[model samples]
Target chain A: MTTNSSDFGPTNPPASMNSVGPPAGVPDSAAFRSAGPPARMPDPAVVPPTGQSAGPGAESEPAVSLQGVTKRYGDKYAIRDMNLKLPRGRVVGVLGPNGSGKSTMFRMLMGLSRPDVGEVKVLGRNPGWEANGSIAYLPDRARWYADHTVMRAFTWAQSLLPGFNLDSALRLAKFMNIDLDMRASAMSRGQEARLMLILCIARSVPLFLLDEPFSGIDVMSRERIIEGLIEHMSESERTVLISTHEIQEAESLFDTVVFLQDGGVVLAGDADELRAEYGSMYATMQKLYRG
Target chain B: MTTNDWQVEPARPPGMFWALIRHDIKLRRRRGVVLPRRWRMAYAIAAFVILMVSVTLEGPKAHFYLNAVWYFTFGYPFMTLGISAGRIKREWRNGTSGWWMSLSMPRWQLVLAKAISSFIRALMIYAGTYLAVSILGAYTLVLRGTFNAQTMGQFLLQGLEWNGLLVGAAPFMIAFGVLLAILSSSSARPLAPLMWVVIGGLWWGIFPIAGASNWFAVHGSGQSAAITITPAVFPAIFGSWVLASICLFLSIYLMRRFVDISQA
Candidate 1:
């Protein structure tokens, strides 16, 4: 449980995939992986069986919702029958190993990619050009505009996007100790990540999707990014769906956690409840991967 | 879950058409040739001197020398097809296509920005190259004691007609290039080159119907090739604009539903 590597390093191997339903503690929703063909079994405890998920002081609308969504590329399924409803004004950590369809889910939510089947709604509407105003989406594997200075990039963003605040962005950059005159192509990966986070954080939007903001970042930059994120999230009524493999570092920020494997939800619940049930978010991850 | 599944992106530029123009300007030096700033200036100067000297010659020799410059002025848009395609492809090449797509603008607006920017870039290159060439050619004619004010005056009108034709054809060239770029990055890539020829081949059809060589010259061919501007120039330009609009419409339509930035 103490080890933080992506690998679980199982102590007790669970039953084989063919002989078992989900390994001892995993929810029935994980049956998609065990049954060969996907079967959606939204656990009543984690997934809202119908309508929007309601959190403490939650409004009528969920920040984002996906209903029986399945996206395929050629012959392979990137996401298969995924049903997710994230509550408004909550920090939901999307935890999964590589190839767990995490980025695919974010892309679908941002309307960059449409599902082959089912529906996805972001900020109470179908994700599209019109729905873009209420959501600040940070894509996985994004690079800064190679030719722009941080100031120019900010100016471009402020002009084009409806909710971006130029003062906040400049202040955020200063707070992160970055030089605005630096060209985007010359930025260190950590500085670029922090700058990107600032862009998302400064947007006056209700929903924020941050996909893998910590990979390859240095310790100091990660700490600053987390602090900046915490500062912004605490001050606003923002709903954020963040996907990260750095579970231990990001675990404290999650109000709820969803663990995915092979494009299906294997374990999900309130972060504190999961901590009490399985020891910690890390421990729950271990159990989910015990198979 | 894999590397492909994670999108911890840097900030995307805004989706406004002007935003792309600003970005393109920043990268202008880096496009095409990889020369240092001083070397690029030197090359332009050298080309200018050569064109000036060439214009001073008499007979077929002057025509032979100036033909390259004329072709560059008129043929300039053809060279930009790859450039226009490359401009769109650069987003994918830099792996920022998804970020560009996520910006809150319509897909057509994105493609339109590129088309317009490419057109502007083509015009800038044409203006710079020919302006210097024409000025220097006139200067050389003066130095040779054969500078004719009347020929020089007629050249201005010829220049406008040339500009008009280019202005008309530019949309089709740039729009088709954008279409080629999107299609080249798509599942329909195998058919792109063939599609380019069939659709863009319509550009040549106008030349035959309107009479290609009569009214189009950038102060050329000593005397024989230096024809005055014709009334047909207006119809020719109008025809090119029609074809260009069709290409732009096709590009916007395809970009909305078919073009996948991630694949780029």
Candidate 2:
């Protein structure tokens, strides 16, 4: 099943590809130096911004742009006439309560959902097949193939996703303490979460849309996942839009944060600015969500 | 990829469509459409026991009973329909459906591969059923000193001619099943199976109008009557092919326009 000449077995991959890995025997993930994004990480396919970014240095083309986008499922609307722009090369956190259309918005950005009105542009073109290559998506409530062990999952991704970095994936798996031979069905929830994150971050793609990566995991696993994210962030500059309810710990990861409520943005700005104005991101979100 | 891995030419790697087909086949080899593996296994064992008991007691009459396996082909189209919808539904239900939309191939190719995998699995089951029954029946007839190759061959050929209509209808059934899975809302999903029957019934309605009764009058009068077919089969199969094409087109359209296949 090995796709490449690399030592990783079970999945076949193209040639050699490396991910950002910390030095061996690092006790604390927080201390792991992010040597800056892996050189192979491609520039996010961001379209020239027609809308303005509210963040600093907004003049550079934004990675994602949505204009009056409305998506309805039957009688109810998922995202209603929403407009926003996300800057490239920053970690953006999408925070919202349950049913705030966070998942729907991600689906639209991935070209998995159609908008009833308005437009969505990712990396300069509409999402779907055209934008698929440049984006790595981790859908909400998604699990790995139940039949697949970590080794098989590596092979599955390598065979299907051309840019899949098997070497980094293997290293990440080791760092996460994930057993390569364990089937997804047999793994704990935390193990599965770590495995899924490795798959997304190991890719050489620019934009990452992660929905609920931390949902229903233990505190320890959450820290490990955060560590994985930090590793990815330090390795290279990439546009990552992560939506999660585990806001307290992940709040610090965001350079920019968008608060979604009832399918539209209630508040959005630079994370540091929002913190200065309202104290912690958790407090700001609680105020916005309750109010 | 090196050429030495496959039985085909090693120079060129498998194209996306072929690669997808290979992956899809591997996916379905273990996962059943409707039932769990235990139930399916129990079913096969039960069928084997019934066949063995019937052959032991009834001798050549078991061949007469096994002739009913031809009627099982009529069940193939519906089985194909279920497998087709199940394939798409599993991806959505599991949250591993990113590959479905993210692949840089044409939407039509995805639809075609979905149908092909389901069709292959259902056909394998369908053909396997007939193969088992026919082989056992043949052996029984030989043991009874009544194995008439020409006579049995003619009967089998006649059954093929009649059952061939279901084979023609299979494509339409498979395509419609896929469309129904995507077109229907989650709340409306419970009704999908009944919808298939109604749609399938409407397709079957054409046979009666095309003079199925007349063929029955001429060739289906008795057990020993000559099973001649009316010339309506070509038009029937042709009409189904046309409808199947239309279904595939509609499926492609839905993917490009309104349906977010994962949610759908």
Candidate 3:
């Protein structure tokens, strides 16, 4: 087990100062120990049978859960024995560098790729089954048909996905300055990014998995896109998991944050709580990553 | 907010299937013509001119009609295979298959839709060519004062037989092409050449190994050769249908189990 000692800094801090100091309620080391290692965390000894209810106090199950999940390619581990639980009605930022298994995790959640071992559940059901309908995913790469116009794509989404809202999609596209008549193949990289965002945000699904949503767009456009996303998110009981490397730009949108390093979660907790402990979210993330 | 409030309504299979079919058609239409408009017009005009010249010169004979039957028998399937293979190659090249998978529809439905769309496309092209040739052939026969009930009935029957065989063999060819596209490594590059090579090798390897080389040689000789309607013909037709069904099932299985959108 690899313990990240730097994450065991604070539980409760003083009312005035914001620093990496020990706090009340739980011990600093105890929190890290309870959560187990960043990778290969031990699986739950007692797994309830399918269709059976979880134990007492576990009535509100997570929107997305992975227990002892490991995915490998050749001899290299993309992600290994990583356990994660994302609650509903929150925007959790999965901050990681390139090749940190962020996209792999998103693929597993969407059932675009399967894990080599262990269980992956989305909305209390296995992914790639009925759960696929409930999860609206925007992958890291552009997957739209090249010949389709924006309006055509919207029409297709409306036809295929029960949760898609054409009016909202058009509204979002208008806000993004994306022309409804422009061919998808003719669009620039930034325009394609905006188009994908509109497609994902217009869906009223339970879980939204966005992998690198703002990769190619400029900072100014990304801000606008993020604003549009936030407006739509406010109208629904949705859980969003955005895997991105642009931490400073998107930090304000996160209710909770998980910092992944080398395909392992090094630090994770509530954004404000970490902010209170380390003065700022950036500061906390920088400290954890650098350590 | 409650989790129930966020739950998405399940997508109906029938609705999803139709949507996929619609999307595939729209994609094909947007890609426009395989042959340019002027070229297609030129070909049609040339075909008409050739028919007129032939009728004005040598007149229509039974051999001319037999040649038409031969062309329909051998040429149609090869054309259909080429068109179906092109459809798969285009989908992979343009990333349309990946986009389709990202939708709410099941993977099997997506594969089935592709197969159906490919068949539809191939049938359209084959039907167009057949009608053009048949109309010209009939006109020549009419000019020669040979358009009798018996002759017309024979022509129609032969046309039906050729079309039936083509239709029976279409599903297998389409499914095989789609499977190759799904299993291909590169998204930007066309897999048709490699697929053709592999398929050609298999056909060559199977005929002699199955001791069917004599059967092939007889059928492949020419329209002038004496044709025999043996018991093997029925079994061959039945085998083609079975192979088509198996290929379709295998394509769907490979799509659901192994194909990944990210790879495409």
Interface RMSDs of all predictions? 9.6, 10.3, 3.9
* Model 3 Cα lDDT, one tens digit per residue, A84-198: 7666667878887787789888888877777889898887778784677777888776556767799988887887775778899988998889999998777877787788788
* Candidate scoring better on DockQ of 2 and 3: 3
lDDT of 1 at B214: 55
Candidate 1 residue lDDT tens string, A165-185? 888888889889889999777
Candidates sorted on DockQ, descending: 1, 3, 2
Flag the better candidate by DockQ, 1 or 2: 1
lDDT of 2 at A146: 75
Better of 2 and 3 by lDDT: 2
**Candidate 1 off by > 4 Å:** A1-59, B1-68, B203-225
Candidate 3: residue A214 lDDT (0-100) = 86
**TM-score of each prediction:** 0.82, 0.77, 0.76
Q: Give all candidates' CA lDDT scores.
A: 0.68, 0.67, 0.65
Superior by TM-score: candidate 1 or candidate 2: 1
Residue-level lDDT tens digits of model 2 in B1-264: 111111111111236677666566545322223466699899989988997887777875433543444565555676777777777777676656665666655677777888787677666765666566567656666766667976478556656664555566778888887777665633445666876677878868856776744533344433334545566566766777898888788777766665564355
DockQ category of candidate 2:
acceptable
